[model samples]
Target: MLQSDVPIRVHANWRPLDPGVLGSAGPATYSRNFAGAPLTNTWYPIALANRIAGSDLAPNSVDINCNFSSVFNNWYFGTDGNPPVNQYDLMSVVLHELGHGLGFTGTMTVNNNGVGSWGGGTAFPVAYDRFGVNGSGQQLVSTSLFPNPSIALGQQLTSGTLFFNGTAARIANGGASPRIYAPSPFDPGSSFAHLDEATFPKGNPNSLMTPQIGTNEAIHSPGAIGMGVLQDLGWTFTTAMMADDSDGEKVGCCGTGKSAMMQDLKMPDAEQARLVDAAVELTKASVDQDDPKFYEQLSQSLMQLKQARSESIPVEPVNDAEESRRVFQPMRLRTTTPETERISVADDPVWRDNFIKWLSLPRRDRLRIWGGAPVLAGEFEHCVAVGGGGRFCCTGTLVAPRVVITAAHCFHLGCIGSRGEVYFGLNSNNPGTGRVVACKCVPHPDYKLSTDEHDIAVLILDQPVTDVAPCPIATPSQIDDAFFLRLAGFGLTETGRSGRKMQVEVVVASNNCSSSSHQSTFGCKRDREIVAGGNGLDSCNGDSGGPAYVDVGGRFLLAGATSRAAANSQRGCGDGGIYVRIDKELEWIESVVAAEGLSIACDSEDESEEQSNSGSVKKE
Candidate 1:
């Protein structure tokens, strides 16, 4: 047995054997001191040993028995007399006998006439008896119906067909139940206690515990069925102990085959246990209706475990490339940006005045845009209204079915206290169209009111929004040199209350651009912040946390979140505003999504390459 922290006492003794029985190995005797007591410790059914039945002082033979209550230790091999060879491996025999001492043998005692009795009829059935069933599916202990219960049970043990009813054993056997040894003409110590020799012939991988051992054959480890039977007998084991040969062939004691088996069995059972525990936890916390992927992941882990045991192989480490491919990738959406010659607002003073007037108006009077019309139906469907009831405190963008990205400051009133309900498609006045309550809100840990460096938070919806698809996020490389962008939101506009969603065009401004107060503001950090809107169109008070989109290969990708209006601009919504760059926080976003088990697909280069190839083919 493997070394354990628990201490146990074992005693070994040897006596001279009769030469006539030299071919036979001795039995492993055990006594249950605390009969009927619960097995709470590693050691139980303490073992005791008697003299060897083989030739006296034979170097090729070993006569050692261990306490099943204690771990097997101190294996000593004999060097005198007929020394060990490929035919007889002293260590292999010792381990096999030790397995017998550890509850592998049946508790039934038989007489010359094949009559049997168990524990002097004082104790309940042992662990081995629990799985024994006759051909008629009747339990072995129910032999009271016979006039001579012992004789009837003995006859059954010698000739009747018996099956093991352990669930794990059945599963391991490919749904075919496992059978026990029961040959004609009752044989003591070998009949009821072993697997039938006829069923598991010599060279059969599962013949470890059979009644007879073949000459010149060394069986090193218990096969898969053997391990499963032990499990049925309440013997706990690790995945390594349960490992088998890849080809399902028995391994001999002397070659590299035995060494390889031992090596494969070295995987710590604790690691497998941890995996099982994780699977259980995921199962308990999973919402089957909300995420079917949870079940998929759990199934994958289970399959790994099954593969580990069936093939006697260790769990393979996950490949980074494979893992990257498995992660969710966001889908890019088609944009409606017009390709016609555009009008520049650089010299348009009248439009600038109109934008200022729109911002200066009352909240009830200001529209989402100065001269802009309602957003083309279903254009910015990923945009959501953030707040409770028919009122919205801010705007947000959905990057995942259950995840919404918004400003950290929006939760100033405490995310829970704000009691917000995210509206996925709020183009109309109907609140019932796409409303979902926020289940959780997570803000960037480094976010601060003073610096606003990490002004981002993600809201988890109570239920996934399936009607509208999420918007694809932009990478730093895709948005760094962007000269123009489209801002969309349900914030205040010239039309008042920003009742309907609206979009406007904005131009990227210089980094040094400051507000009217002459304070160096709108400082654009390549990774953290972006400055935009030198044009007449700009975000107003209610537009904070809304999306700033850039055209990437004719698709609209979310580049940033509306952060703040230009402090130096004559009107807060007129000149330029600062937005939190999404590319800067991609790592944090990915981490949070993974930790929460929220699925969000990211754009993949492989998909882009495939599209490129298809387009080239079309062009040809």
Candidate 2:
């Protein structure tokens, strides 16, 4: 049984002029000719059998002029087998036409540039509702008569309102050479739906309208399969077979193999035009023999023509924002939090990069901070100096087997050539104590130096280690400021101590203050203090990308990273480290981790919730 899925209602009052419509050679003359052999490798649709009112009409040839009762919709089928003058098969032709009618065939158009290119400029045709044939007052012309000399086989139903989207019109009876016209197809009251030029097969040489058919064969043949025709329109097979397999021998459709039709217009159009134009100009030059100026004039004229056409047809810009947006997903927290705890990430430091007086006003801008006391911390761990001259560096966490998570900016430029190592599971002043692996840095694409959008990075290790346990990534539900987080990183020991990767001593800080950074409609943020060193709580130079984790329900919930600080701002080793906001971007981080096929290490969700609610107090 044929599997029917997307059923479309058949149009009522569907009546075809002929089973096999013939075409003329040129548009100027009306002539009669014998019909070609019936297309056998295709299927045809008769009226719907269930919808027929009375007699059953077998699939047979009928007079083209006669119309009988149809089975389904408003179709008419001729039942008698009279070998009628212009009669033909009913089911076959309707099936083929219905393919176009039901949006099965593709639509496309090709424009010929007489001397520039081998094939014409091709484009997908728009199936507008204006060109439908099921309208009243349509003056159907005999297939024997060409509509216009240039437009060999076109139909014009409406006058002023109908047109072939701006082509010249013509009268039947072979008055004018056939030319495709838009006037008759777009009558003011006409509904030209689903009629597109691209539906026709392109590049077929043997056609009624093709020059090869000539006047003698034109009156009896269908037009060439131009641009968009498909065999599936009438064929019973779900897919068109590339070749005959009767002998069990396989053959390709085109000469030996069937390949999908692929025409890249942008890649070859300009080059093809250039070559053709040059060759034609050269031929003209040779024809002019001694006159170089004449050949130059011809070339210039062709260039001018191209310029004029380009000026007439303006190109529209294709919007790519939708394509770009498809790569990102909406972020949300899985668990609910109290509205009171939802706030921004952190506050700016008090000191700012003040503007200096200049003779000619040197163009320079600096960070300007308003207020807030510096929260400080004592010591740090698992951090390192990245670049040479203290220009750039960041903090990181050794999370998994051969995996470290850090900010995206620290190793972006340097890691492209060489990766920095991770020093973890040890306090400052010692090296090579923890599992040290060569880091393989992966920076997020959205990471930018200017905006610092996705300032997160992942470090792949040459080998996995088992010494230290990794931290669990916070889910949408676990993002809360009720649990104060622990921060550790390799930053400067003091303000002036630059080269040393000194670890900071731990200090407890409130996740309370409101920062202006992480305030978005989607997720909540904690602007509280981080790992401050001297006067500040959290992180410094080597702490920029370091993790800020809270012990929630016995599991570590990473809340933030040390991202920035005020210009020349100084605090205790634990008091002044500004961290990159992590909780607000957990979804993004999760996507990246999932894409890399890496699993995060942490405790169970229920355990975390129970522990947080129990109010378990701990000393760092």
Q: Per-residue lDDT tens digits of candidate 1, residues 122-217?
A: 344444555666777766756454322468777666654977655545555665657777666654445555666678766788876665553345
Q: Using TM-score as the measure, which candidate wins?
A: 1
lDDT at position 213, candidate 2: 13
RMSD of each: 30.0, 28.6
Model 2: per-residue lDDT, tens digit, 1-620?
A: 11123232333222111111111000000001112112211111111110111221221211011111121122124433122333333432333333332222111111232111000111111121111121232322212332211242233322222222111111121222122212333311111212222221223221212211111111222322211222212122243332333454322111100000111001123433554566445434445323434433332232222211111110110112211211111110021224554321222121100000110122221100010011113223334323222122445765555556777666553522245566553322223233345556777677755544566777776666664455555543454432234555544322111223332222222332333233321111244223222222234444556666655655556666655542223322222334455545555654655566665544355446644533221211
Decoy 2 TM-score against native: 0.31
Any runs in candidate 1 off by more than 4 Å, and if so which?
Answer: 1-370, 413-419, 513-526, 605-620
Error of 2 at 331 (Å): 29
Candidate 1, which ten residues in sequence have the lowest lDDT sum?
Answer: 253-262
CA lDDT of each prediction against the hidden true structure: 0.49, 0.31
TM-score for all models, in order of appearance: 0.37, 0.31
Best by the lDDT measure: 1
